[model samples]
Target: MAQNVKRRERDTAAAQVIAETFPPNVIDTLLAEAKETGTPIDGVDGLLNQMTKAVLERALRAEMTDHLGYESGDPSGNGSGNSRNGTSVKTVSTRNGPVDIEVPRDRNSTFEPMIVPKRARRIGNLDDTILSLYSRGMTTRDIEAHLREVYGVQASRELISNVTDVVVDEIKTWQSRPLDEVYPIMYVDGIRLRVKDNGVVSTKVAYLAIGVDTDGRKHALGCWIQDSEGAKFWQKVLADLRNRGVRDVLIVCCDGLTGLPDAVTAVFPDSIVQTCVVHVIRNAMRFVSYGDRKAVVKAMKDIYTAPTLEAAELGLAAFDTAFGARYPGAVDVWRHAWAEFIPFLDFPPELRKIVYTTNAIESINFQLRKITKNRGHFPDKDAAMKLLYLGLRNISSQRGGESGTGTHGWKVALNSLVNLFPGRLSF
Candidate 1:
């Protein structure tokens, strides 16, 4: 009798395992139908699509039950103040594709669905997915078709527009937000894009100021789009920056734009405006013949790489004799920018590299260019601002913009700055 009872227990355990492994789940029913009809299970009408729909539907029903305080077919729910109403069908986009799901409703109309909101046309990561594609130079139409073909989700152009439009408020808040009171070095530059102005398409410039604070991390202080680049506009931009915060700036590095030094000096009187050395070299290279280019570039290189101000001056005199007559325009360019250029040379070799070049801001321009490449023209400055802001938002999140750029050797450079200027880079 004991052996018979033990055999029965073993038999029951085996049956239970079989049931758990191959139960009457939605997939089983789907696969059974697929096998009998020999239909593929990866298409829009495939078993996988059906399974996603079923899972999401179950989640929606659960959300509704929680809100209504009863489960389906529960008799206790009848006398409750609010009861389950029939489900409503809504088309939603998923990573897998677009699926039509039934969202449960309540009789009192107070049931707010949290799993999938009533007004949400796209679910899950669809918003982020489309925004990412847009940031990588994909047009709305291209994004729309890509979703349909790759994920089997049909996203209308208007829906895509609305999804991206959500960033406008975020952009406004970020643009007007307060900034760090003191930055060790600031690199300012412009990224140009075509945007609509008063119904006419025009080229607009997005001027961005990137700062390296006391911690060696990179921060984009602000980005502003205007009809064109101008000193008056920049003065206002600088004033706006002052309004937000920025009590003191130790050094401002930039490609020399006429009147920019004055504009920055006006807002930050004590801030030294150091012209970017790389820009001077690139501009100087234009007039030299290909054969003489290397020689001219090397001689010009000697000026900035000099160990002392006297040595740099000697290098400049030598450069004048070698190539000044042949490329007088280039010579004049450097001579004019000499005052601002001299500030960077006063630093230690470690600190000079960080301040003498605009590498940080240039990398940011490359990022902004990719975002604006797909759009022929933005509807207006606000639209352009919104899209560019979203792109910056993504870049900052990826690079931890708040914590600074944290690039290699920056800590060593910051230490050099502190050593060179005693009280400039402290909290």
Candidate 2:
């Protein structure tokens, strides 16, 4: 009798294991067999569901708490060291899956989570999805549809806007943050945006500043909106940068904004200003005939691509002799901007590439344009500024490093600046 009872208990345990492992159909079959034998298969679905949830919760909690350096019920507690507010755990429903998170509480109640915090009951993964989509140049409607189809979660346009807007304040603070005392190379440029004011939409300039540090890391200094580019506005921007701790900029690459070189000289008297060769060429090309564009561009290239300053001067003289009658204006622009244009000629080939153009800032403006492509026009200057600033922050945060080319050139240029300035510049 004891042998028979033990065998029956073993058989029952085996059946329970099978029910848990197999699909719903298999479990139903096992339940039917139990019913026929006047036995019960109770709480199987609920138990299995609870067990799965517990396992997932444990894994997620472990991941979240790993770097926190605290455990449950410790007297000193969670590295925060406040005992009055015990740790509160909250369950958030996310699109990827549900997660159990520990909410850190404090006496001041001012600890706002920069990553993911309590009261953010929606899925944390959704923010990542939106950011990813935004980076890939997706429109708001497209992002909304993607979230709906991929995650089976309904996210509204307004919600998406609000989520992206969270970066605005952060961007503001970053813009005003202290910068390194010396930047080897600084690139400045502007992109045009349509902004509405008093019910009229007009073009506004979005100015950008990109700095290359001593270690070859590229940093975006800040962005601002202005009616137009001029010496005065640029002086203000430079002053703000100086206030933010930029003691010296070695070489400033810019387009031909009149008096801009003077502005840089005024702010950082020792800094060299180089006009963008690309911009100068493009501006020159605009005055040439379409039929002669190819030849004209070739001549212009010779002027910038020459191996030395003397060779470049020879190339420019040849270009003037060749096209002076057909496009005298183009030749005159080169002559006028020659001072700014020729500064790059004084540098080594490695340094010339870094200081010859404002491509770094232009690349950043391209990204800004992509982010604002879908918007018809901003309502005001503030709206335009906010969007541009946030877009820049989003880009810088994702790319994680300087967004520029010619690192070797930047390093060489920086060394030259250090030699020229002696002790005034610091990294």
lDDT of each: 0.81, 0.72
Q: Which stretches of candidate 1 lie over 4 Å from their true place?
A: 1-43, 46-48, 105-110
True lDDT of residue 223, candidate 1: 89
- What's the distance in Å from true for residue 229, model 2? 1.2
True lDDT of residue 105, candidate 2 = 54
Query: Per-candidate TM vs. native?
Result: 0.86, 0.70
Query: How accurate locally is residue 229 in candidate 1, as Cα lDDT from 0 to 100?
Result: 57
lDDT tens digits, residue span 249-333, model 1: 8888998866678888788888889999998888888878899988888898889998888898998889998888898877877
TM-score of 1: 0.86
Q: How many backbone clashes does candidate 2 have?
A: 2
Which regions in candidate 2 have their CA more than 4 angstroms from the true location? 1-93, 97-121, 305-314, 402-406, 409-411, 419-424
Error of 1 at 306 (Å): 1.8
lDDT of 2 by residue, 1-427 (tens): 1222454588699679856878799667756766777653323223333343455455444433443445546555544743334447765545543445555555555545544554675743467567667655576788889876755556788888777676666667777888889887788888888898788898888888888877777777888788887889889999999999998888788888766887898999989888899889988888998899988988888999888889989999999999999899999989988998887777766677677777777777888888788778877876676667656655765565234333655556667766766886654
Clashing pairs in 2: 94-123, 218-402
**Best model per TM-score:** 1
